[model samples]
Target chain A: MSRTIAVVAAGAMGAAVGARLAARGARVVTSLDGRSEASIVRARAAGMIGVGDAELAGAEIFLSIVPPDKAVGLATRMAAAIAAARTRPVYVDLNAVSPATAREVGAIVAAAGATFVDGGIFGAPPQREGKGPAFHLCGPVGDCAAILAGHGLDAKVLEGGVGAASALKMAYAGITKGLTALGAGMILAATRHGVGGALLDELGASQPELLARLAKGIPDMLPKAYRWVPEMREIAATIGEDRPESAVYTAMAEFYAAVAADHAGEERETALLMRFFAGRG
Target chain B: MSRTIAVVAAGAMGAAVGARLAARGARVVTSLDGRSEASIVRARAAGMIGVGDAELAGAEIFLSIVPPDKAVGLATRMAAAIAAARTRPVYVDLNAVSPATAREVGAIVAAAGATFVDGGIFGAPPQREGKGPAFHLCGPVGDCAAILAGHGLDAKVLEGGVGAASALKMAYAGITKGLTALGAGMILAATRHGVGGALLDELGASQPELLARLAKGIPDMLPKAYRWVPEMREIAATIGEDRPESAVYTAMAEFYAAVAADHAGEERETALLMRFFAGRG
Candidate 1:
């Protein structure tokens, strides 16, 4: 009674999860008809079989891991694929979209008579093979938790339907990434005064406990800010019109984008962001 | 061989320092002919001897501890006393004024053939007897550090001239106090969304290090913010036209003033300010 898992649009995180599942003996198929060469290489390296549109019909689980802007379109495509299949598969829209967007995707999969699960990834993929990050899930899938646990992956079922998982990610990212932007802004402003060294020393002396945490946490978080920008914007949109804290993260995305554009030819955007803070740029 | 120490316009901090010196067997005298009864009472409690204008002419050390706006006028009055003195005393200006103002005071004292020292206090008076806060001194006065050390008080001599001691105090206060104001503003803004609890919990979970400090620091510092408003403004002026970080503290002063005005009841102002943040006001 083996189950076939179809991972659509396999990139870094999707490929990592699919690779782990395939290595653990699940039949994994990835559709790579229009993906980049880098993504194709990553999917093949994960030991996933390249499949055509018709081959996806036999999958028991269909995971959509496209960009936030494309989540609804991908969900519509997956819904059409289920309609064409001999047996419908459980469809999970794991992209970083708003709760409203998630509901739209949920309606698409529901119209096609397939189970819809809302999922979000909190951490990055493992560098090697066996270990991977937790996948938080919610929505109208009763046995998804047991299924995920059976595969040796951590999964948490949150409250509400379709939107709660995205809300948690949005709230968590707003503060962590917001603080990074704040520290960068303050440090740069202080340096312009020719008293940054003095200010840092004074902070250490007067508020040693706060300064200790800020110095350690801010620099460590800067390198990962570029990757988190889109996710932060998605979280902001999910929180909707009333939450201005979401706007704070959108501002952070702009800050990181500027940092990315400023240091174009060096390392990855994340690495260059860190180097700018360290005074290399 | 005993030296007379004159403390002009004795208030909370001035009286506290004078008392500490008096407790160590130094003769402490204060001019109290035109001062308010509250100040006279504080001077008596701090062990300062009330002296007439004539008696101030024989003192060996003169300390001007007046308001920032009144510093120059008080310096002029002290200059008349210095001119009448049988033997010149070492003059110290410990008001929260710009460096230019201190230098103006320096010119007055030097014209009367007296040694001048610029000084600033970095913390509140001791709650109990026989203890004092850190005091910083600058300007050309031989063994000023040794004289302060002899009084059993925490004192340091900054080498960067008259402005350095004030600059150090200003820079230190700006960050420690500025961050507290920033935290309060953000927390209040988040409360508008009716999800402050969720936001705080998320902050604690994602950024435990920063959130822990903000919770403890902001609440403790808000009550004392009223007393700091005047000094912060003086610091802002002392940093002069080039430093924009100074404006942050000036903005905090305005915020504290608004909170203070809203909490106008003499007996319940502190409690009322806390209630405002708790959303009960």
Candidate 2:
């Protein structure tokens, strides 16, 4: 039997996940309003169908991928939608929000007599045709593993209820992305001194492996950093409830957001950042 | 014939270097006035002979290892001593001073017709017997390699003249010691936020190797960082001449000096810094 998968507030990642499921012959329905034109175009390009509230009345699985700041509000609206539905769908709050928010969303879905699963995506949306990144899912969904596996989505179930998945995401992003920022800063400082070459030579001499990794890693990641800023903020806010010290990522989000905003006016900011990372600026 | 080695302004490192040569059977003479009691005791324990200007007249090698602030003054005094010596000696300036100051010392030695070698010690003085660290030397003196080899010191002769050795030292220290300061700040911030445990757990889970190195490195180095602050300042001054942007290290020196000052009165600062590094603060 075909399963109905409803993706709320469909954006790049939401569209990607929906398209991947739809391609596998599942009924993938995405909420159409309150999204950017780019998001709508991306959803259409990814083969996800935009549906009204009436068309989403029979969804068997509800996957919420709205912005983290709007996670609770979306959950409230989705709870009302599910209440009016002919059948209650299993609610999976996949938004990058704190455990407190997730728990509130869980309560909303539970009050509507629907099952809740907490899910967090760990990588970028699948860009090429027919490829998907890791989608880590956790909670007490009776058939989450089988359902996700059947559709070829890599899903892992962790023990700590609503927050563990977000915690893992926050921690991983903090190190990988945080080091990227540090590497960029150092490279810029070196270039400004006109001793970038000398610094790299010394780094190669002393810490060859790390220097090589940093050289390769920094430049390659700069182009995509702008897209990750908001996601990082979402993860930071979600995990910060339990791990308040992760506020560094909140600062990092601001740092990357500034770059992203500047990128909107002059895409050259990313280029400049990359140049600095390569020790050429 | 055995060569005589005279160390001017014998402080901790100067006394150690002189004593190391003496231990290897070189005739070592060190000036003792205005030195700390601990330094004098260390020199006595290491079998270095305390000598006046007349007694240093016959030495074949003169090493200047005074503080950075005293380098020029000591260089002038050593120039007078070298002029009065019966035979010209190879003069090595190993003080942490700007490249310009090093050149000035070089001029002083040249005025006395003595060969000048600019050198920088890369590591701490030997805490135990017969375990001195490496020293990098470069200058007009082509016989520096032979001189150091004869005295059983691990000295590498780099290519550039008076400033290259100091440049290399500054660049290397900038990364290693700069990272040390950064890690110190991050760990302190983490502990202050009451999520030190979580940060440690995350670091262990994500970057075990780096965290392990930081754990071992920070605590062992913090107590000794006070001594390195002035050396860092000297290196900054040297590198900042050709590269005025190396002022970062001067700032770092001030930061380390502040940390040292804070730790001097309160045992808690050192203990807290160590705990933060070990991820248990």
Q: How many residue pairs clash in each candidate?
A: 0, 1
Across A1-281, the per-residue lDDT of candidate 2 in tens digits comes to 78888887667678878877877778888877877898888778767788886566468888888766677887777777677778888888876655566788889878977788877775567655644666666678678756876776766565556665555555445445555644554454445434456556556655665576567766655555575576666655643434332444554565566555656667655665566446564
lDDT of prediction 1: 0.65
Cα-based lDDT at residue A135, candidate 2:
63
For candidate 1, report its TM-score.
0.59
lDDT of 2: 0.66
- Give me the runs in candidate 2 sitting further than 4 Å from their true place: A1-281, B8-16, B53-58, B65-73, B95-101, B104-114, B123-133, B231-251, B277-279
Clash pairs for candidate 1: none
Task: Give chain A TM for each model in order.
Answer: 0.80, 0.81
- Report the CAPRI category for model 2: incorrect
- Candidate that scores best on DockQ: 1
TM-score (second chain) of model 2: 0.85
lDDT string for model 1 (B1-281, tens) is 54578888777777887888777777889988888998899999988999975566567767777766677787777777777777887777777666667888889888977788887666666545544666678787577666766866676675557655555556555545555555554454434333345446545544566666666666676555566567656655655545333444455566666545544446244553255445452
Mark the regions of model 1 whose C-alpha exceeds 4 Å error after superposition: A6-12, A31-45, A48-59, A62-79, A86-89, A93-98, A104-114, A124-134, A199-224, A232-247, A265-281, B1-211, B217-281
